[model samples]
Target: MHSRFLRLAVAAGASLGGLAASQAATIGLMAPLSGPQALVGQDQVDGFMLALEQLGGKLGGQPASVLKEDDQLKPEIGQQIVRKFIDKDKVDAIVGLSFSNVLMGSLPRLAESGTVAIATNAGPSPLAGASCKPNVFSVAWQNDGAAEAMGKFAQDRGVKRVVLMAPNYQAGKDMLAGFKRFYKGEVVDEAYTQVNQPDYAAELAQLQSAKADAAFVFYPGGMGVNFVKQMSQAGLLPKLPLYSVFTVDGTTLPSLRDAAAGTISGAMWDAALDTPENKKFVAAFEAKYKRTPSEYAATAFDAANLLDTALRKLGGAAGDAKALAAAVKAAGSEFKSVRGPFRFNNNNLPVQNYYAFQAVKEGGKVVMKPLGTPLKEHADAYHAQCALKSLP
Candidate 1:
């Protein structure tokens, strides 16, 4: 069943690519188009395409064209795509990077070229730390923020002996480290899985034996769907509570369906968030795509909105890439984000709310419902380390 779902995801992604090719502002998207992680890349593409449609096929009053490429979730492929976008397509900006390793490979090139790189995902800690650059910005939460929120929730709920799991990558390590920063309870076991491992049967077996009260994981894209399905099949869904970050969202929720019911995750946005901006976005998204928008969709929407707002400030003349980049950095809080009141930190990462969310079947669809708010008006710990005082 999981294999069939993955195949269908790839097919859908190919169809979306065909649709994007028919349109004309040449926005470049680099993601794992083929591999174990393709489902996540597909989700990022879907969310970003939806944002483009919402903008009426124009950014800064010019017709939009998207140049989509398959990164295959490999760093080398990611680097190649950035070169292709910059050298060949001359894309105005780049967006929708799903993995940290890919971003690490691509960011330096984008930064050195002074090209705008608005990440719809992949907020690795290094980008928010010493390696921070002016040309790159993230529409997503910093790698550690969501996990820290989950950890805080676990502490508040008095969960002891939590099991931890994540892909062995930069963002994964950062996520676990951030969780530990807030969660002081005993971690029964800490397991690092291969980045693209398809099956989790052995890991699930070990987890059952460990008898942890709760589990925290940072499996994104296809891994999240596979892990949750195997956990349900293993009968661990109800027996042991599971808490996760970036595991159960728009991308994986549809594939998991009822299997994801009762699973808890943490994030800044959900489909059911009741706010004026979110309502408009959710309603339009569902009306157009006949599916509920995930947090990925919201973030992608913000990315497009940010670009549009920035270009508008520049009077729709995007000829000077350097001027546009500076304009975007200066045009703060112009776009109405789905998450309420989001702003860039000194590191060019987001300072936003973190909410604890649970998967619940709402009107026959699995939707993430916010349970408790964790960080209100939160700033990442690394913000104080940044020396920039004047607005970017």
Candidate 2:
């Protein structure tokens, strides 16, 4: 009986010691890795890994494990992937979603589990507004936020009659609405094409017939590349003053080359953003990838750093949902973002700067140059609709 009691006491002590130690953290990144947007997804993954590598493969001195899964850019597949991460892999955190449709499918599951989800790319309006949750945060700006900047730019540039185009989707609708919200100009034509549609010849024909002073577009990923090249081929490149959001990006711009030149676009991050954090991030990314980092990759990089900061504050409490939410909010309050200063609004969206940039030719190459700041310390328009009792 004495020997048995001693053995039991030793076992109990070992269990208590294990409990006191911090557990290994797992972060599951879900993005479209096998579809048309594979390049975009890979960029996000690369950005995230770059940050993690710089941090010495650890988040706040705790061992970290990453589980990456492809959503295939399908909503159902994305939902399944996220569910598997939560139920089977038991990831402590969730990050990365390239498309808003995939984000929409994953949000409900994230809300149910109350796990911290830092959106690296997609920032749909619903998540920023009525459907906002405590655990869901966006390292990227709201989808409309950048569009609003473009709208303000057009309005300032004296564009009176502008044509707008996007894919027929939730983010597409949000982007157009955000553009119209600030443009205060006549929309001569509006077009919503099917997503991933290779041919924009028909849309270009309609635009060629229209009498718009300028045009704005919100195509992203492969769609942006296809549209820009097709529009250029259709004899609309330099002729029409084309402004876009998320269209003329690093992922698309290289493919576009001269076709993307003279195009004005708005984004939260550009290589020319004057800041030490941005310079360091840009240098590291270019050195690592041998190319410029897109806004999607920049945001994903920020998400990793932001998660690291929050996990450090949480310490051993990283697994605690309520505590983790507070830590995330605190981490976002004031962070050295690659894009510059980053603050979290009440809706868990970023309040950051937006710049109007034009694609220009330099040294026999096309590059984006910042023209001016359209939006400063910008927050989403739908934050008031986010009615969450949980506050950090």
Candidate 3:
């Protein structure tokens, strides 16, 4: 009997140690890696890694472990990966989701599990409004905010007629709606192309016939490169002004260097954002990766920093989900972001500044020059609909 009691005590102690080890705080990154949008996903990963390095591998003064899972850019795959992260890996939080569809599919799981998800990209309106969940937060601007800023800029520039195009998806629809919200001009043609359509020859031909004053689009990833290259080849680049959002950011800039020149885009942050955090991030990213970080990367970096801020406030304690949630809510209160002052709206989306940027070449490198600053402290139109009061 005495020997059996001693053996049981030893077994229990070993099990307890394993449980404690498994409970160590970790952040999971779910992103596409094996699809056309992999470049965007990779950028997000790089940005998150840079943030982790800056923090010396610690968040909230406690050492953190990062677990990465490939979502494959498919909604079903994304859902599976998120489930694995929550169930198998037992990650305390999730960050750096890159696609709108993926975010939508994974949100329900995150909400049900009470797992905090800090989106580095993809702010679908449904998540920001009707389907909003307290556990889901965004470091990136809402899908429509940047495009709306561009629409307003186009209107201000006296663009009377414009051709609009986007992929046939939730984000694409949201982007078109956003542009139309502020454009107040004739949409000579509103085209919804297949999500992965590579050739824009048909659409470009249509735009030529329409002879619109300008063209606005929301193509990202390889679609942006293909469309811009074809647009330039089809002789439209010089004929009509091309205004876009999410079409000329960091991921596509290098590939679209010459083709994207003279284009105008609207965004919350550019690689050239003039701020200390941005400067450091850009320098570090270029130094380590040999390329300028894109807006996706910038947002991922912000997400990581936001996570770090939340963790620090918690003093490295683990397992208090409610307290961690509160800490996350307190994140933007003190941290200065690359895009300027930002705070979470009632829907848990960011309130940030948006800028109009014209793509220009400087010393053979593509750069964005600030054309106008639209919102010094912008609040989304949906904020009033949220019942949550502002953070004190």
Best by lDDT: 2
Residue 59 shift from truth in candidate 3, angstroms: 0.8
Q: Write the per-residue lDDT of candidate 1 for residues 111-146, one digit (tens) a residue.
A: 888777777777888888878887777878788999
Candidate 1, which segments miss by more than 4 Å at Cα?
Answer: 1-24, 362-365, 387-392
Q: Where does candidate 3 clash, by residue pair? A: 60-311, 60-312
Cα lDDT tens digits, model 2, 1-392, are: 11110000000000112221133555556777765687788788878888888988777566555667777778888787777767765556678865888889878888999867788887899998999999888888898988999999999989999999999999999999999999998999899999888889889999988978888999888999999988888888778899999899888887899999999999999877778998999899999999988887888888878877887785534657777777888888756798876788999888889898999999999998889989999989989899964344
Model 2 residue 202 lDDT score = 86
Q: List candidate 3 stretches off by more than 4 Å.
A: 1-23
Q: TM-scores, in order shown?
A: 0.90, 0.92, 0.92
Q: How do the residues 1-392 of candidate 3 rate in per-residue lDDT, one tens digit apiece?
A: 11110000000000112323433445567777655677888888888888888888767666655666777767887787777767875666777665898788877888899877788888888887777777778889889999889999999889999999999988999899988988899999999999879888889999999979999999988889999999999989999999998889889988988888999999999987888878888999999999888898888888878877886787666356666777877887667687778988888889889899999889978788988786666777666666666686
Candidate 2 deviates by what RMSD? 7.2
Which residue window of length 10 is worst by lDDT in model 3? 5-14
Model 1 residue 16 distance off true place after TM-score fit, in angstroms:
10
Itemize residue pairs with steric clashes in candidate 1: 24-64, 24-65, 25-64, 25-65, 26-65
State each model's CA lDDT, in order.
0.77, 0.80, 0.79
